[model samples]
Target: MENRKAIEAGQDITMQKEDFAALWKTIHLKVTDTYEVPPEILWVNGSTIGTLGNFSASTGKAKSKKTFNISAIVAAALKNDEVLKYSAYLPPNKRKILYVDTEQSKYHCHKVMERILRLAGLPTDKDRDDFVFIVLREQTPDKRKQIIGYMLENMPDVGLLIIDGIRDLMYDINSPSESTDLINLLMRWSSGYNLHIHTVLHLNKGDDNTRGHIGTELNNKAETVLQITKSQQDGNISEVKAMHIRDREFDPFAFRINDNALPEIVDGYVFQQPKQDRNFPLTELTEQQHRKALENGFGKQVVQGYSNVIAALKQGYASIGYERGRNVLVSLNKFLVNKRMIVKEGKGYRYNPDFHY
Candidate 1:
């Protein structure tokens, strides 16, 4: 009643200055005294995609298997399994995954689900309440956003969310303001929920870049951006390259649909052959050679310096130049370090042979 009387008198309709300060003090922190260990919350192709509250994107041309790649990621996250020969963050309590497909018919989407289940090694007949798949081809732009917003708000356990057709969420991909707004919403949702969000985008038909202003904005804001492209050497193979990454980027890897119609990495696959010239940098070696060196180095199971590792690589292939060999050795060492296949020692590193590729 007293508060009502004060309001009726038209004195200070807004919150009082002292009350606002009290509310601010509840959440304020001392900058120098505050410290926190970053969360380990992202994984793709066995590499750390990023920490929590980060967004990543995958882009490809039509029929480039962009959806399939993301499906593999979803499978890994849900089953706490590996995908494309890479490990993922497997929480003690498996968290729910929400996959929203804005394009594709119901029939095609079901096939995607089957492929994901197969990759996760889960039976198709089993009940999967933890993984939710929503096909929203008919939903309006506004409606789709509303539904996604509701899910994010109500389902606190959803640790991973994949939007297959992220471009459809905005009415105009060419509009800078619209694209900025959509990305802002995604960034806000990701940070607010402490979740990782992956979105799929289509690349320009004639160019390697993603389509329109929206793609540009997404690339700018995303912590990791993967590019999927049909191999020029073979039509059956699709190459996935980490175009931009905040952390260490893995070498480009290729996959093809197996007899089971699932995406599987081709072991010993070489995306491209290096130019046959002594002048060519060792860094330009084929993906196969890189993997071979990495496997050989890790096979030793002993602490090895970079020079010794390069010597071992040259033993497998005599064509590697001294500088080129060192480059390859360093690259593979970084990759293995990031993948947790090896640990750095005093002026050397020890490889873990038991670590699965």
Candidate 2:
């Protein structure tokens, strides 16, 4: 009512042409010649995983070694070396990489830092100026985003940004609106800063897919998506495959946790063997069949052994299950070797598909 009375009293309430033009000038305009292809910073299996001005994602089940694999990538970027036999090209004139952990505790985050440094061949005694690690486990979603934005804007030397727990930045992972907003923010940050942003996500337990709408949106927006899975034959080993890529598909690779607590690519690792008509399709078995197979004597023995190896890898000997499991696995491996069902390979044993367990 007061605004109406003011207008009636001849107040100037209309947008002026000069004011409108000033606002219009804020929009950036560029010619076609000014545009160029985004530079690829990280490559895996002939596919580009990290490209400047774009985003990528890595997802897997809990304790599937998603973070561990990412640590290897970060190490490669820092050292300007190859990761999993793929070249990691550093951004021009940039030597910094920022890693943000929003889920792990301070001690765990410190362990991650140590692992990255060790894998990158850096001495732990001296502080690193090129790599920045931030832990925001106690921060709210809003505060975390604020801090990330501030860092991206201020840290001009940081060419790569890693979000270890991307779900922490969203209020609800299943909300489509929230997922959309989160992806938009990520795109903006990647393009505005002209850097690569890699995010880690959790997968749904019941199936080999990411959690919710957030995962769907991320898969769509990401230029590359890497899926990490625990090996059924050897729980200590994790297989990483490029699930989606903007370019050509990359071959899969496998890695295992070394004694130094760093992920090392398994030597002469074969992801899968050639299909033979006589060989049973163990990899293509149904869920029910998988469960039933684990219930039988040999299957049960092998499964229990793998479980113990996984436990030892994750929790060490703190649990009696690890020791018991390892003993059972050793016995079972020997029996399988005698039967020719499994053969010893580089650092581990490989299952023979020709023989049914």
Judging by TM-score against the true structure, name the best candidate.
2
Q: Write the per-residue lDDT of candidate 2 for residues 122-183, one digit (tens) a residue.
A: 89888888899999999999999999999988988778899999999999988878888999
- How well does each candidate superpose onto the true structure, as a TM-score? 0.69, 0.69
For model 1, residues 1-357, the per-residue Cα lDDT tens digits are 998998877765677889989988756888767655546556655467755577889999998878878877877776676778545673544288889999989999898988898889889887687888999999999999999999989888777888999999999888878988999999888888877888999989886656888876775578788888888888888888876676767778889988988899977877676343345344465656545655554455554666775565545444333334466555544455534455444335555443334
TM for candidate 2 is 0.69
In candidate 2 the C-alpha lDDT for residue 183 amounts to 94
List per-prediction Cα lDDT, in the order shown: 0.74, 0.75
lDDT of 2 at 253: 88
State residue 317's C-alpha deviation in candidate 2, in Å. Answer: 54
Between which residue pairs do clashes occur in model 1?
none
lDDT of residue 233 for candidate 2: 72
Name the best candidate (by lDDT). 2
